[model samples]
Target: MSDALEKAEQAAREAATDTAAVQIALAALELAKAAQQQPAPQHHQCDHQHKPRRSAGEWIGIACAVCVGGAGIAFASLALAILGGTAAIVVLVLRSMWTDVQKRR
Candidate 1:
């Protein structure tokens, strides 16, 4: 009689384990369905507003700035030319001094 009871208890334990596995599989299926039903995330776009055209006064200001910039660039070129000429003159004078010293030697 004891042996029969032990067998029955073991069978009950196995059935319980099988029921838990079924419950877990059902829960997983439910999760998969919920995931598939979810809506895709939407991207929000900003409405681009065009900037107004520049006024006549702004145009005149831009032109003045361009003229001033051109004048500044011209003056910088003239300064660089003057510096190059001065450097050439100094080099020539030094070369002449060196030749004179060699002749005296």
Candidate 2:
């Protein structure tokens, strides 16, 4: 009789442990489902895309670059003009020399 009573007590303890495990599994499943659900969006916020604002230092850097580029273009134009003037002067001197040679002939 005592052996039978001990076996019954062990069965009851095992049942209690299984019940607790089942409850924990159900709770974990509920938590997982809740985590998978997405939150609702608020209606008050605007969805328009925005450009990032430039800093003052960045604007100053851009201005400096533009000024330098313009100065470089101006110098290039001046160099071309000097080259053209030199070529014209050479042509005029060569024409005068040809005329002098023709008179000697």
Q: What is the C-alpha lDDT profile of model 1 across 18-75, one tens digit per residue?
A: 9999999999999999998999887986699779999999999999999999999999
Q: Write the per-residue lDDT of candidate 2 for residues 6-93, one digit (tens) a residue.
A: 9999999999999999999999999999877967665787689788999999999999999999999999999999999999999999
Give Cα distance to truth, residue 28, candidate 1, Å.
Answer: 65
Question: How far is 33's C-alpha from truth in model 1 (Å)?
Answer: 52
lDDT of 2 at 11: 100
Q: Could you tell me every candidate's TM-score relative to the true structure?
A: 0.53, 0.49
| Consecutive 10-residue window with the lowest summed lDDT within model 1 | 41-50
Which candidate ranks first by TM-score, i.e. highest? 1
Cα error, residue 67 of model 1, in Å, equals 0.4
Worst 10 residues of 2 by lDDT: 38-47
Clashing pairs in 1: none
Candidate 2 TM-score, C-alpha based: 0.49
How far off is residue 61 in model 2, in Å?
Answer: 1.0
